[model samples]
Target: MALAPEPGPDWSAALSHLVLGAVSLHAAVRSAPASRGAAAGFLLQALAATCTLAPGLGTREDCPSGAWVATVIGLPLLAFDFHWVNGDRSSANLMLGAGMALAVAGEHLGPEGCSVAGQAVLLVVAVTIAIVAVFTANTYGVWGGALLGAAGLLSRLDEDGLPLRRGDACRWALAAGSWAYCRALRTQRLQWE
Candidate 1:
């Protein structure tokens, strides 16, 4: 009998990096401050949404338009980071900014050169991070992030194989994260009121 082809390095690295990154981001957001940290957390959730959406419209090559979209999305995120860092934002904001910067670095490293598995892993990581951010941030941010991450994960599954729906799990995590944020916010509001 013929043996199955071994998965490439890109696949393993992508998934591993994503999971690790998510864990790191989650920790960073948890310790972040209320103002800019919350904004940075939302930005991460937005990134998760973008990764999920990118695949469905077309492959990276087929859609130059997508690159434009990426630029538009990326610029504001960078600005957000800069603001957080330079404006004497909280240490939590700085940490969140650092986490996002790391994620962007990972994306640049992976790019089109990475294998399909690698891309899937990246999405998984993104969703995981977004979920964590949601729980640490506000209700609106959590809900929006969860929805976007879910859509992204679903699209990613369509491209890759079905046996492991890691993307889907990430989306559910986002939802859970959102729920956590909502509960936290409600509690806070009740105390204030």
Candidate 2:
């Protein structure tokens, strides 16, 4: 039997990313001047998502690298912003930055390497966010951290051609985490104002 052609790009995933990106943009626009760093991280995600929204401009295969690069850079910015927003300079920001650096290095090693790198980035970002959440006493932030970590784990354990693929799970987790984080950012802004 002749092999059927593969399906086109996943429109749902792209749409979700676009929506999340828009939410992030709104948060950024509402944030104060100094706190815009966190919003900047989300903006990168938005940019990556926008690129993927166009089938001709960026196919799925072309999007992950952009997404990964954005995540790699964005997570630390968010972490550092938290550090400044909370007015508590912890060495954890340094560690988070180092972790992102390592993830970037690992991504260059190949698919397995990229998977591991992605996992590490997610874990570090999760842990950092969790720390910030604890300091802020924001329960939603804690859940956001958990979701991000779970997404990382799911991505790492994902295999090819599963009925419920890892990418879908990760996307859901990311969306939830992003929403929670956005809420947390809002709370932080309110507290400071």
> Of the candidates shown, which would achieve the greatest lDDT relative to the real structure?
2
Q: How many backbone overlaps does candidate 2 show?
A: 0
| Backbone clash count for every predicted candidate, in the order shown | 2, 0
Across 1-193, the per-residue lDDT of candidate 2 in tens digits comes to: 9999999877666666677667656656655364667777777766765676665887777787777766777666666676677776675468556756864585467877776776777788889889888877988778889988887887767457455567666776776777787777777767788
Give the residue spans of candidate 2 off by over 4 A. Answer: 1-9, 32-34, 59-61, 90-96, 99-107, 158-163
* Whole-structure CA lDDT of model 1: 0.42
| Per-residue C-alpha lDDT of model 1 across residues 24-101, encoded as one tens digit per residue | 255335534543434344345434434424347456563333322232332234223323433435533444454445
Reference-based TM-score of each model = 0.33, 0.79
Local accuracy by lDDT, each model: 0.42, 0.72
TM-score of model 2 vs. true structure: 0.79
TM-score of model number 1: 0.33
Q: How does model 2 fare in lDDT?
A: 0.72
